[model samples]
Target chain A: MAIIETADLRKVFRSVKRRPGVGGAIAALFSREYEEKAAVDGITMSLEAGELVGYLGPNGAGKSTTIKMLTGILVPTSGSISVADLVPHRQRLENAQNIGVVFGQRSQLYWDLPLRESFALLRSIYDVPRERFRENLDHFIEILDLDEFMDTPVRQLSLGERMRGDFAAAMLHDPKIVYLDEPTIGLDVVAKEAIREFITQLNRERGTTIILTTHDLADIERLARRVILIDDGTIIFDGPISRLREEYGTHRTLVITLADSYEDVQVEGADLESREGNVVRLRFDRRRTSAEALIRRAMERYALSDIAIVEPDIDSIVRRIYREGYTEGAIGSPS
Target chain B: MSVVFSRPRFRLEPYVEFAKVAMAKEATYRFDVFTNIASVLVRVYILRTVWVALYAHNAAPSELPLHAVITYSTIAMLMSLVMDIDQTRILRDSLHDGSIVLDFTKPMRVPLYFIANGTGEVLFHAVLMIPALALALFFVHIDVPSFGTLAVFLVSFLLGYSVGFCINFILNCTAFWTLEITAVQFIVTWITDLVGGELVPLVLFPAALQNVLVVLPFAAMFSTPLLIYVGHIPPAQYAGALGLQAFWLIALGAVSVVMWRLGARRLVSQGG
Candidate 1:
């Protein structure tokens, strides 16, 4: 069964229309003009237990809005959502007990309290049993290596330490699902890897359903097997990572270095993209010709000293999806 | 995994924990505590001196004795300290920075959590302000109420605290609509100081203004309790004064509840 399900979820914000300058400010008070903006529009998706899905969108693309609705922070204007068998907005407190939320730019821990105290307070808020709280605490502490700075005040801790503390606080109740919004944003590479590894372990061992929204493609690549792409408040793409590659990531580059300078170097089923002295680059569709076949043909035509095949990186694929909308042909394709 | 204890049913445990954490957090700002005490002392001194000078200049004796006015000023300062709600800035900051979304996601009502946290800060200030109150009493002569009146005063003070919290909660709810709450804060503080009898005792006001102000919720927050404290409220009117306080407490509390519900809905819809 799906741990979270949303059908045609939508949220529209109505803002007062204000004119510019002093006269406009005065006019605004007297005149009631409103403009409606749709932050999340007609999004339908579901997440099964232990499934890790990355929700990707550019800035102001409604990624956070959808997460907010799912977590019950914002009520939807239309549609229905069921998280952990509870309607989040209608049963907010009950739903809150079963889900955890983390935001990269925000710290949920009390500013002046030590990390340990914040965790204890969260435990109380969630009503986790004392022993269960301890078990989760010990487990996260050991896994995240929080012993070193657990006693430090949250405001005094470094960004990485604070994020770690926030993660532990969110999970203290052993919530059934966790929503991570840009969890690794603004962290160093090492810190990012640590968080990614922790997320992977959490999903593998605890069956925690995760909905990750991040700008960092590495986070999506390392942690999420499934991807849900949104743009302008609508879901544009939903499929496995491999399908994303197979569809938009069709072009592959093969670079070959010749043992000796050849005036004529030709290969079938591959376009000679560029040539630089003894080195030449060829482009071919992965669907049409294999890298091995291209290389075998290149060897037959010229003396090859070295060869390298470059497939499209996930970052580029995601960027392309954002720049140019994904086609409907990519949906529901097998990995 | 080892066998673990089952999760317990939700209770007031979280609010108590929030209160404890808030108290501990306030304790860290020692310099702020000292500054608050100094400011309160300075304010008391200024008000006392102004009243003494006014009394000296008056050709006719004032209705309230000089001693009684001094006592009102002193106790009003102390009452203000105890009844003050400290979550205004926290609310504004949270809303401005969008952390309020995370706050709403917690397993507690936003108003209750804030009230609990603010109460903790009030408790802390109440303890620390004892010495300051002692110093104020040394400088002014205050008439002690009878045991019955004292009991009435304590009840009035509790109601006053609730009134103040409701007012503060309502004001803070404006954060959902406007990000810059400084103007709202200033207006609220000024009006509260004027109408709540924090700056001038309600007894000194014109008879008509006093009649009107006494029935307002602002009077319940400061003037009602202070009147009971200094024996200014007649024994016959004691029940009426307490009843007025209770009325405002319930009425303002209901208003706060409505405002909170509407404001929370606005917050969610507006994507705060």
Candidate 2:
């Protein structure tokens, strides 16, 4: 079942045209010159129940704007959004009851109060049943390892600890869907792993639909099977992670180390990418020449001591796509 | 489902809890509370001295005596402890910082939460007023009105507060159109201090102008309650004064509701 859906969703922000200098600034006050930019332009998509989808994009790619509309914070300039069978903007209060949101850069926790007090206040705000609230709180405390610093003020907590508390707070009411925007923006390896584990558990155990927007590719790689890639306010790609890899991730890197130093080393089918000391990096298309064939050519040409073929990671592929925009063939059309 | 038949169920628990949390947050800064009380006391003493000096020159009229003026000034200062608090300051701050988006995602009414938070802070300052009032009483002699007058004053004061809140809310809503409102806030605060009868009684204005000024909402917020307390407005006119306050409250309340809806739309459209 599709738990969330949007058709041609769009959000346009109209701002006064700001000028360069002090004189221009004064002129703008009287002039009504306006410029409109569509932040989320005609995005159409749907999410199935219990699906963990990575909503990926670069900065100013309308990722946060889309999330805001879905969360009913930013009303769309046009188009329709239905989350849990209700229009999010029109039925915002009802939709809010069914959704949870976490903005990693900003915390919803009270800064002066302990995590416990924040949780207790959320309980009243959501009107969660006393018994159920207790159960959820205990579960989150155990899972997020929040027992040690539950009484510490939010301002005093480390980023990781506060994030854990935030996750718990957003989930206390058992929302049917969760929107996590950069949930792991700034965290150490262990903290990142803990959050990813918690998110996976929430989606799998509770059958909750999750739409995660993150710049961190590792977060997308680990938790989301399906990914939606958007840029310039439109959907460019939408499918499984494997399809993303197959479409844009065709380049392979071959690193060869030579025991004997040669003034010049060259392979016929590969282009030299980079070199450090004795080791040389070569880039080649996987479709044209196999790694085995490339290795055979390098071995015959130079006295190689070690050779390894590196598959293109999602990071490099995404970086390349950003540098050179994707084609319509691999993209899902915006409805 | 008929809309008229189906009354919306208003939840009070969330606002109550929000107010409580706000109170708790306000209590955390104990030193600030003490400093606030100290400043109010200092101002009261200065006002008492200033009024004494002004009366010595017989600049004041016979209808307003020295003791009555002292009571009026002292009560205005005390009333300012709660009334001067901009309940919609949180709204302005949130809009500026863009944290208001999180508030829009909440299940409850955003304005109500701001009100509860403001009420919590006002209640805290209201408690501080007790000590400040006591200290002011020691410095100057203030006339205590009869029990009936005191009862009427309290009712008028509440209406005045509602009117003040609506005005503040309406002003903060301007932030939706203009991202910055600090200059506007300063201008409005200066005007309120001058015309709201906070610094000087409206009765002292020219009798012809006094009638027009009293009908203004600014006077409804400060002058009505203060005048009622000082018996400048007699028993017969209590109903009239309270009724005008009620009128302003409803008028401003309706304006605020309209402004709030329009402002919220602007905020969401601007992607705040």
Candidate 3:
């Protein structure tokens, strides 16, 4: 059974329509005009226990809004949602006990207190059993490497250190589900890898269901097996990361270094993307022409020193999807 | 019957823990504490000189002589140390930064958490009240009431503190709609200073205005307790005065609850 479910969950934000000039502003004071935008428009999805899914979206794509609703920080304008058998907004306190949240842009640790003090406060806040809290704290400290700065004030810690602390703070309660919003944003490569590894360990070892939202596709590539892509307050695609790669990652780049200079290189199934210093880059559709077929066509036309086929990275595929949007085929059937 | 019997017990541990954290955080700012004590002492001396001059120029009222008035003003100044703080400032700030979502994710009552945190800060300041009080006593002669009056005055002071907290809390909740509340806060502070009986005793006001102002919640916060301390409100009328404070407490508490509910529903947290 799905541990979390939302049926047509929606949140509409109503704001006053601001006028342009001082005259219009004064007029607005007398008679107000309100404008409404649906931040999350009729989103419906479900996550089974122990599933790690990436909730991906562009900025203002209602990704955070949906997470907020699920975490009980926001009340939806309409529809229903249940997490761990409790309606989040309605039974918020109970739901809070079952879920943990970490927003990368924000740190929940107290600014003045040491990291250890924050954990103690959270222990009381969640009413965690002392022994269980200790065990979990120790586990997270080791995995996240928190012992070195445990006594340092949170404000003094670097962003990477603070994020590591935030992760531990969110998990010490042993929440069955965790929502990570941009958890690896603005981190060095090393710190990013550490967070990713910790996330993997948490899910695999504890069987914790996770919903991760990030603009960083690398995080998705490394940690999430399933990806749910949304844009304009609607789900455009949902499936495995590989399937996302397979369906939208159809284009391939073929690079060839010519032994003899060619005036203009052309292949039947490919377009010449660029060239410099006897090296040529060509873009082709994998479905239309295999790499061998394209290479055969290219070699027959020109004397080649070396040829290389580049598979589309998840980053470019996602960027293209975001820019040009996906076709109807891009949308996976509801699970 | 079963539902009532099976109702969950109220746990005080979390609030106590929050309070402890707040205390620890407040103590970290050692410089702020010393500066605050100095500021309070300066205000105490200035108020003393002003009151002495006014009493010398005009005949003092029988019920509220110069000494009684001085006691009222001195104690009111000290009360403002703990009472003037915007206890729910964290709420407004969190809303501004959109970090309030983190607060909502915790399995705790946000309002109670704020109250506990605010109380902890106040308790820390209450400790500072000692040295400040001692310093002020040196500058001005403040009459201490009898033991019974002092005991009743303490009870009245707690109620007044509740009244003050509710007023501050309700005002801060406006951030849910306005997002920027410095202007509202300024206006409220101005009005509170005028009628709160902190700067001047209410007994000195005109008889007609005094009757109306005494019933206002502003008076309930500072005037009621100060009046009790100075023996202006005698033991015979302690019940009525304390009852008025209690009534305002309940009334404002209910209004704050309503405001919080409405504000929370419409909260447009600044950004993620």
Q: State the RMSD for candidate 1.
A: 4.6
Candidate 2 total steric clashes:
0
The first chain of model 2 has a TM-score of 0.96
The sequence of per-residue lDDT tens digits that candidate 3 reaches over residues A178-206 is: 99999999999999999999999999999
Measured on C-alpha atoms, candidate 2 has an lDDT of 0.87
- Arranged by TM-score, best first: 2, 3, 1
Q: Summarize candidate 1's per-residue lDDT along B188-257 as a digit string, tens digits.
A: 8788889999888887788998889988888888998888887778889988988988888888889987
lDDT for each residue of candidate 2 in A1-335, tens digit (9 for 90 to 100) = 79999999988888788889999988987886899999889999999999999998889999999998898777788999889998777777888889998899988888889999999989988889999999999999999999999999999999999999999999999999999999998999999999999999999999989999988999989999999999999998899999878877777889999989998878987888889989999988777788889898888889988888899888887876777777745433211
True contacts kept of each: 0.65, 0.58, 0.48
Q: Candidate 2 residues B1-272, lDDT tens each? A: 10011123579998998888887788889999888878787888898899899999876687688999899999999999888888778888888887888887778788898889888887888888888888878877789899999999999999998999899999988887786788888898888888889989988888998888899999999999999999999999988999999999999999998888788877666778
- Tens digit per residue, CA lDDT, model 1, A1-335: 98899999998988888789999999988997999999889999988988999999999999998988888777799999999888887777888888999999998998888999988888888878999989999999998999999898888999999999999988889888999999998999999998999999889999999999999998999999999999999999898999888888887889999998888777898878799988898878787888888888888888889999988899988887787777766523211
So what's the TM-score on candidate 3? Answer: 0.95
TM-score of chain B of each: 0.90, 0.94, 0.93
Q: Candidate 2 clashing pairs?
A: none
DockQ of each: 0.43, 0.49, 0.44
lDDT score of residue B184 within candidate 2: 88
Q: Estimate each model's TM-score.
A: 0.91, 0.95, 0.95
Model 3 CA deviation exceeding 4 Å by range: A328-335, B1-9, B268-272
